[model samples]
Target: MSKIASLVPESLKSSKPSLIRVLNNKYGSDPEMVNLTVGEPDFKTADHVKLAAIKSILDDHTHYPHNWGTPGLRNAISQYLARHFDLHYDPEGEIFVTEGASGAISTIINGLCEPGDVVLVPCPAYTLYRINAELCNAQAVELETSAPDFKVTPQLLKEALDKYGDKVKVLVLNYPVNPTGVTYTPDELRALADLLKNYNVAILDDEIYADLLYEGEHLSMAKLLPDQTLYVNGVSKNAAMTGWRVGYICGPRDVLKALAKVHQAAISTNATMNMDAAQEALLHGDEDTAKMKAEYDRRRKFLMAAMDKIGFEYTKPKGAFYLWVKVPDGFDGDSMAYAEHLAEKAKVAVVPAAAFTKLPVRYFRISYAASMEKLQKAVDGLAKVFAQDQAD
Candidate 1:
């Protein structure tokens, strides 16, 4: 008999291993290593939220959940968005629960795009959008926001729109962005919205980190273009409920109704208890998020000041937990090697922004989601690395 093996799809087969996870695995065994890489919140889930999950389980609510999600969760998400973003989504028709923001992105991209359609992903960004588009057999076209300041400009949008035209199916916009920590102003988003209104592209507005705003308010893209915007949000970052695995999508009723098929095919529903927990968080965990944001703000300031003294170059973070740093001049190798070298010499690991880029670059991202003590230790290690760079 001939040997036989299952074939992995080309989209998944060629996927690169996550550099952040690679480095974490490499350096994770060290007892003293300050892993300033992953953006997981260090805070505990609110007691009330945890208790809700526990109560649900004890109350025998562990059955398979509805494909769309529990009515309570959809309603909670709708109310949460209306209260916070000044956007209204009908819980009955326009909202659908997903596994997480990641799952929701997959559902939307798979549902909205046919093969050969283009998903316009602005970089430097989380790698998921591009990779997911590839998996869906859709083209992931990256528009690199100009350097020094990483905000996407209207002219850039115009150029891409002119080039790709109707082939562009989705425009991904994630603010308080990962790695860079750059966000948009309401006026800035409005400018982009003006251009976008002319195009037929769907706006995939990812607001998973909306509650972590350390600077100006978070203005949802939906606020400017609700009809065209597919709003994605969740309780993971805000409620310290990442392990709970709950997210939701709010958008046009017809689109959401169609997307519900993809949601059902991919993942029927989140666990009932998890949805219960998530709704509780959405309803009552704003105070918990507020406290966490205050700490994250303090950590951001502390890291920026410390990096200033130590000679690591970066724009001041506006929101979210990651600080994107351009590798100082005279550093040897690309950011992956730089990161590995740092882990070996300084015993502190940071994610290379090279992982997030669609083009070549040399940058690393430090996550401030760790405790102040851990951040201080990471800073001390970074100072030594910079000193060595100067000496060399």
Candidate 2:
């Protein structure tokens, strides 16, 4: 037999490049480069939250935590969920705090999927879902939702269930979606709940951006489909605590028990200080989150107006800090090519829409998580590029 060069399977080798790295390579390293490619909040973590973590460290709370998580943090999560979503979870047996939403998702997939199981993922999805599914030896089946609204309709879900049958064991649901920023209404979620109730599928509900809703109250699938949903959330988006790497999952006791074993084997447990900080965030950081959400709402309006003036068609995102803009007329619809042209010719960097999916050229995603001044400058640069395209 030939010498073994690498243990990784061909599936992992074929995974796509990181979108942030691709944009950075195209835009070159300039301190002045205005980046709209990242989805992280521009705000810093609240002062009180940081202080709490520091206090924990100073008090000698640095020892390894319980394999699942501390009772205090899990209890905070349970209370937060019930208050916000009217969902009930027993903190002692139903919550598993992991490193972050990414970690929680990986643990869930690793536990639920056997080799060749299929996971239904909506296209233009966050990259981690597919990557983790493939890593778990499961198939990532992309269900395209290019209709007027970028949502998975009941009929579409039925079609997928028919095609994949029992092989499709998990459905990943991300509201205020990463690339599209589209959120589901309560009615839409209820419909999805009814349909999934009939199937043997479970949901990995990623609600990290739920608190960033600008138009209306956020709805959680766990509220409607608690028995079948493993809910994942964190303070990263709400309190700008991304660097802390703290998030948790809530579900049925049995489901969480299985996930905890996977989490223990993989991570042992999350950082002790970070969990302390996250507990403080969930209990006392609402005011700071509200302030950041207000700022994001303002930036969203400004970005929407800018896209309108630039003559670009886009779906107005009601939540999250992203705008999914369609490429302008007379331009080749290849988002990567257009994004590169804008980066090189217009000196602005935006993530290509295709990075979120394999689709015909039409749409691109622009993040408004930057300050207003940076957004205005990027729009001005894009205007120049569009004008030059018309001239050509």
Candidate 3:
């Protein structure tokens, strides 16, 4: 084997790069490219949040922070949880701040999953979860939920629990889910929570997009089953603070205490200034989030209308800024082929849905996180190429 290949783990060697990122790197630089492959909000961080970070730096809060995050930020996170999701997690020992939600996810996976353990990942999820699990030498079992609008139902939960039995260590749940933009109602969440209560698995509830809802209120799984759930969230999506790299996890004290070891060993404590910014965002940036979300709603409406005019079918997003568009018959349901043709002929980029699952699917994801102008240009590009496909 080559020296470069030998230096890395077998897992890293065999892993596939994220297709969403690959497409972004390919077309993101072009001035004419209307990139729609990433979920990052196309908005600036709020003034209050930015000012708090500057204040923290000036006040010499740059020294090593507490391993579980500063008390104030933890309290802010706790308050935000209670205010938004009706969940109460004690700041003293129930919350651990990390680099980002991605960091929190890796910390939780490493903290709880031993080698050869099983992790249940639903289809059309953020691909990072599967990558993180596989990198940990754990098996990621994909629960294919293509039939029921890309959601995991109680029957689906029971089947996986019965099959994996005791080997299952974690069940990841992402709502307003990435790529698909699907969320559950309270009754739907209750049914899944009830079925999960009988199992011996841990729940990694990723609710980073909870604040970006377009319609109904967001319901957290942690509220229904707090005992075994590690609630994950951050300011990245909500506050347009993606570059700040601040995220947090909340759960029972004992579990959080145990997980702190992984967080400390991996990345130490999160940057103190970033935590300060996140705290301000949580406490005072509701108007900031609301303004950005309102803009996203506008963009979503325009994009969906454009899809209608271009004859592209997709599930209407209720929360999160993504559209799970079907690979039209002109493309023969080949999502990758359609994405490629769109990129070349129309100068628009999208992510094929197959990357989110282990199996193939006839769908792709278009992030509506861009401006209305860009959405319009992307739709026009689609019309041109789609017209060509029909002509062919």
Candidate number of the best lDDT: 3
Local distance difference test, each candidate = 0.88, 0.86, 0.89
- TM-scores of all predicted structures: 0.97, 0.96, 0.97
lDDT of 3 by residue, 344-388 (tens): 899998898767886787888999898888888888888988788
Count residue pairs with overlapping backbones in model 1. 0
* Model 2 residue-pair collision total: 0
Candidate 1: Cα lDDT at 64: 85
Which portions of model 1 miss their true places by more than 4 Å? 1-6
- State the lDDT of candidate 1 residue by residue for 1-392, as single tens digits: 33543466777778777666777787778797988877789999999998999999999998987789999998999888888888898889899999989889999999989889999988888888887888878999988886776878999989998998889999999987887888999999999999999999999999898888888877889989989999998888998888888988999999999999989988888899999999999899889999999999999999999999998899777988988888887986988888878888898988886778857778889999999999998999989988988998
**What are the runs in model 3 whose C-alpha is more than 4 Å off?**
1-7
lDDT of 2: 0.86
